[model samples]
Target: MLDLPEDKILPGTTGPALQYVLVADEAFALHKHVMRPYPNKTLDIEKRTFNYRLSRARRYVECTFGILSNKWRVLHTAILVNPDFATEIVKTTCVLHNFVRRRDGLNCNDELLTSDLPTLPNCNTSRPSNAINTRDLFKKYFMEEGKLEWQHNFI
Candidate 1:
């Protein structure tokens, strides 16, 4: 846990506190800012729907990285340069990738979006109640007000 100062935690925004979280896979540890899908056991409709939605978002992210790595071969290997230069390299690649995509369009044969979902070992660690509650709230929202009509079909 980070021993952040109080001011860092509460930035004094005008409106209600917004919870920003990362959509991660099973390999990541769940926390207030990281949401992972529930275990693939005893899943009810709500859980299945949540998993489907989360997986769909994760797929887009994976596909983007796939395209980037295929285009910029430098990203495939470890970047041994200074941290600042590495950041610039990544930013530049993203800009160039978008520019090229807009101009030439995707040639899937050359820039194939390959996805390899790794099998993660079972994690027995108990997550904090706050994190669990946050995920539950999202699941409830997805099942109710925030649901897309076609989301049920995917589940």
Candidate 2:
């Protein structure tokens, strides 16, 4: 994760302090900088709406990776190189992908490609209280001031 100082905050329509965060699926653990959906059971409208919004954000991430995988075929297969080298390769491809997008923009041939990776077991660790509080704050904001017009349809 990137080191963001306390002063680094995102502008929000309504909220105390909106810090940048990464959206994760249920398989991952919750952290102050990582936002995951609320548990599936016993969800209120606020939680449901938050999950939908987070899913929408995750969809964009998936789509961007789809574009990256399609443009860079090496990403589709297993990279047998060292971990550091693999990281560099992925980063270089991302830079190249952005450069190509800037030069050519989206094309008709672009398609959403998903990779089939082995699923890891769900994280069973207890979530930190601070992370839960942060999620609740965002949920409140989404339900109140930041609510979207079509978000109600999902909830």
Candidate 3:
């Protein structure tokens, strides 16, 4: 690990100093950051920012885990045959969950499509296919109406 010079520790110079030290790496900033010493207050701010970004990033990860738990019941020990099969079971379960979710017609990134972001029904959990279809249609209608209003605003 290259120790940055005293001059490099100053504000506005850290990026260049870090880049110089980690010439080939895109994540020199991260390495430099982790290495740099700071007071408790500064460290607390960094920690808070890290936590906020982590929490935001992890929502998707949590959703994936939730999908796994709900779809395959991976939390159940019945799926585990042995230690060897455990890895395969986890992978297979994720694939199966995704496959079944798609097959059941849940569209990821489908906009709420309402003025105030309408409260969507928790239909993806488990409901009749027809119920899901009906929900989709209702949502689509509102989405179209919202789009029309949005267009009118722009025009």
Candidate 4:
């Protein structure tokens, strides 16, 4: 984490301090700065609704990864290069993806993006109560303040 000053606030926030967060899949851990979807078998309406919305949002991330891997064949196979160099290659491909999209109005061929990559089996871990509360807050926000008219269709 960057040693940003406590007073350096994120834009559009009331407080002076805020930590950046990563939205990830349930295969990853839920922490103070990481948000993930509720379990697949949740029956509660609130949890179900939250999962639907979060899944819709997460689709973009999944698509981007798919597109990146498809466009860069090296990403499709295990990189034999050093870890640092591999990271740079992925980063450079992302930059190039954006450049091509902007310059040529190119988009990912979604139909060709396959889901052949193996995913890690989700390991159930007891999450901290605070992380659950944060997720609840977001769920409430999406249900109320952040709701859109078409969102009802998904529910």
Model 3 residue pairs with clashes: none
| Per-candidate local distance difference test | 0.78, 0.83, 0.40, 0.72
- Candidate 4 lDDT tens digits, 15-79: 33434556788787777567888777845777777887878877877887887887777778888
Minimum summed lDDT over a 10-residue window in model 1 is located at: 7-16
Task: Give the better candidate number (3 or 4) by lDDT.
Answer: 4
Error of 1 at 96 (Å): 0.7
lDDT of 2 by residue, 1-155 (tens): 47666624334653367566789899888888889999899998889999999999999988888878988999888899998899899999999888887788766367768766677788888889988888888888788777888889767
User: For this target, which candidate reaches the highest lDDT against the unseen true structure?
Assistant: 2
lDDT of 3 by residue, 72-102 (tens): 5564345547766986888888788678768
In the range 1-155, model 1's lDDT, one tens digit per residue, is 44333322113323223366779988888887788999899999999999999999888888888889888988877789998899899999999888987888665354655756567885666799988877887787778766889998867
- Distance (Å) between predicted and true CA of 10, model 1? 19
Worst 10 residues of 2 by lDDT: 7-16
Top TM-score hit: 2
Q: Model 4 misses residue 102 by how many Å?
A: 2.6
* lDDT for residue 52 in candidate 3, whole number 0-100: 37
Q: After superposing candidate 2 on the true structure, give the runs of residues whose Cα lies further than 4 Å from its correct spot.
A: 1-10, 13-15, 78-87
lDDT of 1: 0.78
Better structure of 2 and 4 per lDDT = 2
Off by over 4 Å in 3: 1-44, 77-81, 107-155
